[model samples]
Target: MNEIAVKSNPRRQRLLQRVRMEIHAELEAARLQLQQRADYHPTWDYFLNLLMRPLAPDRLQAEVGPSGETFMQFGTV
Candidate 1:
């Protein structure tokens, strides 16, 4: 490849790396802010738990049992 092409590739790669780093930093900041909000607000923690509850294994199994037995239906209740 020509020298200009080679130089341009590395410059483009460096720009991509910087952009990725900036995005990573922004995500980290957002995650930290969410964690801070969750920590400071008991209601936030409870709401997160509520959001996650339906995905819980026992909840899923109880809501829609894995087997024919009715036992699974009572697991989460």
Candidate 2:
């Protein structure tokens, strides 16, 4: 396991989670723009919310789950 995984430090974990969400948002935004979808805002908005959400002790990583009301679903939920 990685050192981060082994130690499970709360502060480091929160920082990692924040960085991960940012990356997800960035990649999803790029993909949506690449696909040339007209209505990418709400999807973009969703990832933005994910990026801004506060860290919870029992936080779960984003997944490729079934989509929300938005037409285009991201690979990372």
Candidate 3:
């Protein structure tokens, strides 16, 4: 059927509503899964990473270029 005929039909409208509800349910389920992932806790290895420091924090330097843009330079050289 043509677009206008399908759109005006009650059966077509019902079918569209059913498909819409199914897609909405899938979207909601996906959102709930993402929400659960967001609430997840990190492992012990994550905390262990915080205890380690850079090998040469003092060697890090920050300076502005001719264009007035700041950038970092690592190492004494």
Candidate 4:
């Protein structure tokens, strides 16, 4: 099938490529920021513990099951 080819102008092609590159760079930057935010939560907790010791509460106790003899630890680190 020898279909007639539609020629793309070089200037437009360059412009499109430039736009795509910019979008890709922005996406990568956003991904990095999200990763940093995800990792910050745990470290933030540790820092709060160190900086706000008196404000923090102690560990909690959980109710036992039907056996009524099994207690479980329940609280954030």
Candidate 5:
């Protein structure tokens, strides 16, 4: 469980490097596909926004009120 031991092991290092490479490759593929197909770009944008929402300071502030209560409003059909 030690971080130093995990990084020092040759097998673990290889496994970690392989995993990082695989993730990078997949992201690149997705980017290429998104660029070639413009129709799904909105969907991709929505997905990215959702993924990054938690990290946006303005979004976080808007979602949580001064009393520390979280609220979301939806429009009626």
Candidate 6:
């Protein structure tokens, strides 16, 4: 059996963290703006829930190809 070790890049990790924080901040701002609308509807809560849901995985998975090359699998945000 062959064992594959997945290594994470520090730079990429930091970048991802920054991006996630920015996204969350933007979502919160949008949510607040929507709530302040004069005609806010309860049905909009469903959409807000979807927007507030987790956008992406904290860490990406590294897969080894048949040729022994490792690549990252980025998840949807």
Task: Sort by TM-score, best first.
Answer: 6, 5, 3, 1, 4, 2
Count the clashes in each prediction.
Answer: 0, 0, 0, 0, 0, 0
Whole-model lDDT values for every prediction:
0.57, 0.57, 0.53, 0.52, 0.61, 0.70
State the local distance difference test value for candidate 3.
Answer: 0.53
The TM-score measured for candidate 2 stands at 0.38
Q: How far is 15's C-alpha from truth in model 5 (Å)?
A: 0.6
Model 4 regions lying over 4 Å from their true place: 1-7, 38-77
How much is the lDDT of residue 45 in candidate 2?
65
TM-score of model 3 (CA atoms): 0.41
State which candidate, 1 or 5, has the greater lDDT.
5
Q: lDDT value for candidate 1?
A: 0.57
After the best TM-score superposition of candidate 5, give how far the Cα of residue 56 lies from its true spot, in angstroms.
19
lDDT of 4 by residue, 1-77 (tens): 12223346666666657776776666556545654774566545555443333222322334455587765764568
Q: Model 2: residues >4 Å from true position, as ranges?
A: 1-6, 37-77
User: In candidate 2, what are the lDDT values of residues 1-77, reduced to their tens digit?
Assistant: 25566566887777788888787677667655644766555556666555444233233554344464433334564
Q: Give Cα distance to truth, residue 72, candidate 4, Å.
A: 49
Candidate 4: TM-score? 0.39
Q: Please give each candidate's TM-score.
A: 0.39, 0.38, 0.41, 0.39, 0.41, 0.54
Of 2 and 3, the candidate ranking higher by TM-score: 3
Candidate 3's residue-wise lDDT over 12-59, tens digit each? 777777776776566556545654775555563343333321222222
lDDT of 1 by residue, 33-76 (tens): 77686347665666655545554433545453356555433344
Pairs clashing within candidate 1: none
lDDT of 6 by residue, 8-59 (tens): 7666667767888898888888899998899999899988875675443433
Each candidate: RMSD to true structure?
14.1, 9.0, 19.3, 20.1, 9.9, 12.3
